[model samples]
Target: MEFDVKGKVKEYYGGIARKVNNGSGKSCCSGTSCCNEVSKTSLIYNGESLTYLPKEALEASLGCANPVVFAKLKEGETVLDLGSGGGINVLMAAKHVGTTGKVYGLDMTDEMLNLANSNKAKMGVTNVDFLKGYIEDIPLKDELVDVIMSNCVINLSEDKERALSEAYRVLKEGGRLAIADIITLKEVSTELRAEANMWCGCLGGTLTIAEYKSILENVGFKDIEIEVAHIYTKSIIENTYLKDKDLDDVANKLNLDEVDGAFAGAYIKARK
Candidate 1:
């Protein structure tokens, strides 16, 4: 990734983290265009109580699926969560990994780290640690992690190859990478691709499924599987309007446009 692109993502998401962490009513899940149902449902499904996280942490959740559950993590193994926004999945992984194991939440935003740290305190969980860094260049030692998980974050990396390589480097032999994110089934229009807000919001910057797989393969990861679990076009169109009501009325009234070859959510599981 270019320095500017990386910096843009960091700044974009960092501002988002700051907004939601402050307990404002502003929605991070498209800020209004998308329905909150998915977020609410995912939280309940993931076993998060309303008391577990702050309002902003809850609001700022942008994950399309639960990577913690998809990862099949076990107790007493070290787990690392890339782009651990607001510590949602990090906290969940922490509980699942138990005190015998350690969970590391690596994120680039200082505000997000602070929010995640506060959530840790609120939950009384002492087994997790939040670190400041980019996922493309993880701060952990090579071959030290048992599992790597991320939620809708890697696609935004300016250098996804570096991110995947870092993921592989930080994992133990036979370690796995389980990610729940957005992926395109075909080519997306350049217009949509150029939207910085959409890109940062986990929409515009996504890779094609084949590209995602190829990158994992290039990084020496095997048994790569990318599954489409959720189709969020309806929700995205909904969010498009909800997040930015100013879009043309005709555009607003039109149903969510199928991103042609786009899948709302995808799960990628690979092994070192």
Candidate 2:
């Protein structure tokens, strides 16, 4: 089957939201892979209560790092989350921005939007709005947003350059972009790069560290800094793939020797 990147991302997240809402238990995919558990420790286990969200939302968290730590957000400001799945980050941003500021969650998945909306209501967050749109072309006014954040979502974009252009367009001058994503430390093999599974799971379709810096620079962003916040280990790899019985078999047959030496997670901050 031909892989439709956009459709696949939407479908994948929609399923996640559905599971979160219905409490039917999420299907075992790379989204819940053991790698994700290790990758999320810093974001969920540290500095905040994970009690605000359901298990599904926690399981759906795919971010490589936490953007809120570096966002340096101010009160009465407007913050936009590019891939606000389950509104976990959106809700967290709401707390930081306070009652004076507003938080916008833009996601392509209706199910995700529904789940986020429900969560917003449950939490009594009046300052947040869920937007149904693509990040490549944000449905917002220019120079209106003060900060932009995404968690492992930008890497899923079929056109990353276009997405960055949109981010720059909607942000005010000096507004910052703090993205937590899976960035390759070295070049990905041709075979791995071409795998559909890798892209959907936020692995195979990553850009090298230098390439990520170059794109931000070309997009007219200054004070750009891409740094490693965490590295995915083999133990994490085994855990993530273990959820999928079939994938576990293949994962064992093929030795992923290149897993640990290169870092798989990073945080990139830049200003427009």
Candidate 3:
């Protein structure tokens, strides 16, 4: 049977939203059954950076890095966050933009949008709006945004080129793209790439560093920079995505070292 990639991602993340809404206290990507507490600790925003947000927003954060820090948004500048999952980045961007600016959060999942709106209301942020839409087909006018930011969400896309093109179309002249996402340093085996669970976990669809830069360039983005923020080792993957499987057997079958050295969380910057 063929796998439905989009369906799988929606199901996986919708479940996460439900869990979080139920007061499970579970992190999105690093839930209790998937990753160890120590591994979960490795993925965090600076404490001071999150001081003003509600506790619900802090707990719902599922990003690998904080793109808001790198976005350098100024007062009165319009900003858009793609895949704005529980509105963590949206709320943070809202703080930076202040009352003069507006921050738009676009997400495909209804449950996530609901959760993000709830968080936005809890934070009493008047400058932010959460819109339900896919990143590949954003619901905004061309040249309307000064900056576009995404956190660990681009890799979840099935058609990354379309998504990047849409991002380019929506940005104003000289607008910036600041994103944090998973990228592969080397290639994974076909078997691993075929797994729906891996794709939903932000692993199956990663592009290599070179390929990512090439795609950004192809989409008319300039001055592209991709910096490795965290490397994912085989052990980490085991604890996070493959915890339920036979680790040793899976490792041997996948030639895990190549896969280990291949994947990392990266910070990507560019301009339209």
Query: Model-by-model lDDT, in order?
Result: 0.75, 0.76, 0.81
Local error of candidate 1 at residue 83 (angstroms): 0.2
Which regions of candidate 1 are displaced past 4 Å? Answer: 1-3, 27-56, 240-261
Backbone clash total, candidate 1: 11
Winner by lDDT: 3
What digit string (tens of lDDT, one per residue) describes model 3 on residues 1-272? Answer: 27888888888777767766887655433435543322342356663346576666665567778788888999999999999878888998998999999999998888888899999888888999999889999999999999999988889888899999999999999999999999998767788888777777787889999889999999999999999988889777766544422233344446566677678999999998
Query: What's the C-alpha lDDT at position 65 in model 3?
Result: 80
Model 3 — TM-score against the truth? Answer: 0.88
Candidate 1 lDDT, 191-252, residue by residue in tens: 66665555565666788788998999998999999888766565654554235322343234
> Residue 216 lDDT in model 1?
91
Q: What is candidate 1's TM-score against the reference?
A: 0.84
Q: Candidate 2 residues 1-272, lDDT tens each?
A: 25787876677677767766786434343454533332354344376666665455565565656677678788888999999988878888888899999999999999988888888887888899999999998999999999999988888887888899899999999899998888887654676556655566776568888888888888788998988877766666566532321245435533467655444778889999
Ranking by lDDT: 3, 2, 1
Clashing residue pairs in candidate 3, if any?
A: 185-262
